[model samples]
Target: MRTVDQKLRDRRRRHILTAAISCFIRDGFHRASMQEICKEAGMSPGNLYRYFDSKEAIIEAIAEDERKENATYYAKLFRAKNFLKSLGKMLGASLKKASDPNYERIALEVAAEASRNPKVAAMFAQNEAETKASLVLALRDAAARGEIDGQLDFEAVATILIAVADGAIGRMSLDPALRTTALMPTMKIMITRFLRPPDGP
Candidate 1:
């Protein structure tokens, strides 16, 4: 159970994170300032610094939170026995959010910064590795359930699926036009192909 002070601190931290993400999206990481972040968060500069020592710290926290959320999202599918059902639910959840124009715009900005910022890049890489490990474990479960054959290379296949999903989301975030046709279909095909049982091999 959290005390009132702890809850308030958590709320403030959340506000700071949301403000930092908005500022980073609007101004890019290099240009976003602590002063601007404070204004966006509706807190004084002194107060903001109490929550986060610097803009980089805030960005790191955001990345860590995003990574944790990603892991948690996939953990649900890993727990499920119904392969196609879990796949569809996951795809639908992702597509619904990514399809939103505002979310897509912010995600694109984050991706651009991720390419140049060493910390952000490393964080994303670590996040990807964790996600892939979770996926491989899930695939192994699917294989054991007879939904997928055991002979298939689970790690390799999980890597390919992760790559495909990342590629689709990255492309969609950059070009909204692609979402209309290729994005969802590519995702569907990947899930279908990956889950399909081997033809007596």
Candidate 2:
């Protein structure tokens, strides 16, 4: 059990992260200053600094939080009766959230920053690698249970799936008119087709 002091500490850190995310989304990461984050968080510079020393630190914290979320999502996928369906629905929900202007801005900004910053790149890469590994491992287990195609190359397929999802997110962010309802059923069909065993090879 967390003590009161510990809970307060966690809450303050979360507050700082939330403020940093808003500032980063409003102004690009490079332009979002520590002062702005402090003001947005309603904390003094010295107080905010006690939680996060830099924007990079805050971003890293966010990445860590995302990884934990991904883990929970995967655990839920494994618990589902249909792994492929659960995966599709989960990713569909994610894409739908990405369509929101705030989510889109933050996702695009983080992806853009990852491209230019080695540390940020590693943060995302690690997350992706863990997700991909979980996907492949889960698919392999599903195959053993005769739930999916046992003969398929799961590693290759996982890569393609992740790439497609990332591309969809990018497109969703760039095209405000895009509809998640329009995309999800097709995504479900694609996942089923890709993972299900055909009569022949």
The lDDT of each candidate is 0.76, 0.87
**Candidate 1, residues 41-148: lDDT per residue as tens digits?**
888987888989986688678778878887777889878878766876676676666666666666666667789888777877888788888888887888777777
Q: List model 2 lDDT by residue over 1-201, tens digit each.
A: 569889999999998999999999889987899999999999999999999898899999999998998899889878889777788888887777667788768877898999999999999999999999998988898888788889999999889988877788788767878888899999898988888887523
lDDT for model 1 comes to: 0.76
Our tally of clashes for model 1 stands at 0
Off by over 4 Å in 2: none
> How close to the true structure is residue 33 of candidate 2, measured as C-alpha lDDT?
95
TM per prediction:
0.84, 0.93
Q: Which pairs clash in model 1?
A: none
Best by TM-score: 2
For candidate 1, give the lDDT of residue 171: 69
Task: Report per-prediction Cα RMSD to one decimal.
Answer: 2.7, 1.9
Q: How close is candidate 1 to the true structure, as a TM-score?
A: 0.84
